[model samples]
Target: MLFGPRPSCIKRLLVIEDDPLTAFDNEHTLKHAGYDVVATVDSGEAAVRFIAAEQIDALVLDLGLAGDMTGRDVARLARDRGIAVLLVTGRCPEDASDIAMACLDKPHSPSALVAALKALETMICKNRAPRKVAGLTTWWRPAAA
Candidate 1:
């Protein structure tokens, strides 16, 4: 019998922000938090293309993008694919509550961003089949049983 460990599924994240600095910071923060940031793009069109091609698990989006298509438009596409979306913007839109998993205002600390991602991860994990290990519960799947 071929015995092997189960593969771990780390959540894949995509960051869509127009600002170069903000995009870099968000990508760095997500990577530091142990999430795989698949891509960091500055336009809604590019985000759409990336989402279409990549297996994105979650998205951190900015409402105001440099392109004609805003983050809200991208959020719709991401949500349709069952990807968790977090809106981070300087101004919160009224409809934001309807679309995203959560909204974080701009000037948010890195800790806040990390906390939001953790919360989203927990929520995602809870929705799936759970497993217990060492007297604790985790949503992460092991490589082998």
Candidate 2:
């Protein structure tokens, strides 16, 4: 629990990365940036499982998973459930499909990741959800609360 208190107080992020090293680095960076990482799954299947069982506020999903399912699939699932998403990939999608809260390309620095998370938090708060996006999202009506 990086942000502290509750999931609502810390922007909860679900990471679906296929590389263990990258996932670890992203988790560490996100923790330092004050986010609560709900789950770090290496495959799209696990990502779906994690989301189904946890209370995730947003997703930092990799476009390439180790399994058959892609990040876009996970994004679609999350969007269907009203969860915000941040796509971490090399190329950005061009369509007006379900817009991700933000997008970060590969080889991102910790500072850049932190900034993205902060930006995503802001976007989530501004989405007419009556949520608070202070140093955290504790001001909103949390899903678990």
lDDT of each: 0.73, 0.70
The digit string of per-residue lDDT tens for model 1 on 33-86 reads 677899999999999999989998888898889889989889998888888888
Q: In TM-score terms, which candidate is top?
A: 1
Error of 2 at 66 (Å): 0.7
What lDDT does model 2 reach? Answer: 0.70
Runs in model 1 deviating more than 4 A are 1-10, 127-145
Using all chains and alpha carbons, the TM-scores for the candidates as numbered come to 0.78, 0.77
Q: How close is each model in CA RMSD to the real structure?
A: 8.8, 6.4
- The TM-score, computed over Cα atoms with residue i paired to residue i, of candidate 1 is 0.78
lDDT, candidate 2, 1-145, per-residue tens:
4433322333788988888998999999887767788888988899889889999888888888898988888888997888877777766676314546556767777666666666555445543333232222222233442
